[model samples]
Target chain A: MSDTRIIKKRYIFMASVFIGLALLLVILPEKSTSKQLKPEQLLLQINDNNRYVSTDEDARKIIAGDNYMQLIDVRSPGEYVEFHLKGAINIPIDSIFNKDKNGDYVYEDILNQDVKINVFYSNGTVYANQVWILLKRLNYKNNYVMKGGLNRWIETVIRPPKPSVTATVNEVALYNFRKAASMYFGGGSVAVPAEDNAPAPIIKKKPKQEEEGGC
Target chain B: MEEVKIQQNTPRKYMNPYLAGVLLGLVILFSFYLTREGLGASGAFKRGVAKVEQIIIPAHVNSEKSAFYHYVKNGEDPLKNRLVYMIIGVFIGGFLSGAINHRLKLKLEHSPKITSKTRAIAAVIGGAIFGIGSAFGRGCTSGAGLDGMAVLATSGFVVVGMIFGVGYLVAWFFRKLWI
Candidate 1:
């Protein structure tokens, strides 16, 4: 074939490929059929809405016998077996979408439930946050993340700290609430020493050094 | 025969770079508006790799431990991914552009100073390094540099700066290949 003819053939081939791809894009099923939230809108929701539950708030809800609230432990099965919040159901993050012998999603029934609230917690906020986002994308309603996850739960509930004497009224009140929550959860709480009334020391951070130029 | 000769000899001029850039920006904006995400190039490569891995070791591709498994686990065709489709469109658009400009000749592009073999070797090395870098960076130039910069992301600025800085720094050593 001549040079121009070959070029024309190549151009026609490319055009055909382009048309084929465009058709495929239009015909193929989407990854998700549900109306999914945009990343920007998701970010806005995360920042604007109260998506996190404080350890105190979680403890209060659990202790108050709130049947409408569901606590989902999103950690590994081994981690969940070791110790988890009372009345919390273990749903390892990996197996959230496992298929049963009947070819139905294992958590389909649970996820489809019309619960008032479903609080997901993991070792930290990362895993829970991931699960939350996934559930949100699936159009699951009333999903929340346990702020700071089990780490914060251990710090605030398992070891309630006593406020210093010089602490503000709000700080002291919050400490008291935490103490009460600790007692309800059967966690140990230390008494505030009268002699230890000094204000907490404020440490000044060193200035960050400028980054070196060039990669 | 005379008309054919005239047509073959006449090559159209290329579009202005500024206009091309503006058009590219608009395309990126429209992509973001439609999909809630910007354009990406390396993701198509990753999906391609995952598809290849799946074909080679089906069990390994389905294993929970495999990082690539997620791409194919949803029963979705890897080639059908949005990025893969975008890449196909890119190839087609590039070829069409070259054809329109009468610049679609099949030949290796290299400076006269370097042999085609040397250029080929350099290209392979450069592509391999770029693939690894893109994997680490979580994106390629089109995805991270252009799309991220279009959104005014901090990482975008940093990556683009690093790319040009490193390119300039190493250009002198490989001056013979191009200059």
Candidate 2:
């Protein structure tokens, strides 16, 4: 073959090969679908008002002892132990979706079950909302954020401002209900009764007493 | 000095540079897609060296004296990693390609002006310097430099540019080795 012919052939071959590679690169997602919700869908979910369970609703559910409702404190273990709802379970915001050795989510039963409604709360909605968004994005149903979190719950239930004397019947009824709940939760926010599901102190070592009579 | 011809008759059969580059680009992209991480040549080697040291002196692996404590800290196994396997795959793939192309040989490749022994000595010294440099730079040419370029990171451009710029400047002093 002549030099010109060989060189031309090589150029064409190179060009065609490159174009083929470019096409492959364009199609190179390799076909894997993420089950997580898209960003826009997640944003909409975040904005939706129905994702929140008001403190009143939360309180009513606890009062009724709804077997289907689960209160999840999305705070540090320390914070949860410091003060949380009467029957709240601690699931720190960071570890909500972590998996066990078997590759199943550690909180999968509590998080994704339709039989149980998981209501997450923190000192504020920030931590609860974070956990809620992540679980919601992962397509977990029956999960909700406790509106205004524990702070609002305390303001409304524990130290409820008495309704105005001219308040409507419904307002008076709500105040009475809150007053009843406040008393049920051990009156004025002393972290419920210590005997009522309060976790024992984690540091078990007794204080060492120096020798009383000897050096 | 006569102008050196880079291409000569019977130029060994090798894949086109452009083809190789495209393949490498695809590999890098796929690496990120699969691992959510970039291609890194030094990380595997670093782990390998650390693992070897751990096997030789188990106590030294985690002690302050060991330079590679980071790899084996908290009883972590440096060898049990995807990168180590990736490095092995790289070696096997390179060998297969070279064999298929009839480019597999035992001879050392060097400039015609230098003896094989001089080339060998220079390569060892140059590689040692580059190994130290990669540690300081946090990754080697393909990992930190090329991977950065693949993602259009400014750091990649800076690293590649500095490598070539310094190379050119030093090549003037070492021209006798080649020319």
Best by DockQ: 1
lDDT of 2 by residue, A1-215 (tens): 59989988988998998799889989898665548888899999888889899998888888898867788888998887677787778889888778899977777767776567788999989988888888888888888899999889999988888999899999999999999988877789556633446531222232333211000
lDDT of each: 0.77, 0.79
Q: For candidate 2, report its TM-score.
A: 0.52
Write model 1 residue lDDT over A1-215, tens digit each, in one string.
69889878877986787699879989998775666778887777767548788877888888797877778889997776667786778788998889999976677656545535778999899999988888776666677899999889879886867788899999988888887877766656323211222322221332233221111
Candidate 2's clash total is 0
Q: RMSD to native for every prediction? A: 19.1, 16.7
Task: List the candidate 2 regions with Cα displacement exceeding 4 Å.
Answer: A1-215, B1-12, B64-67
TM-score for each candidate, following the candidate numbering: 0.48, 0.52
For all the predictions, what are the DockQ values? 0.02, 0.01
Worst 10 residues of 1 chain A by lDDT: A206-215
lDDT digits (tens) for residues B55-130 of candidate 1:
8887887888766666777675667768888888889998998876677787999999989999999999999999
Clashes of each: 0, 0
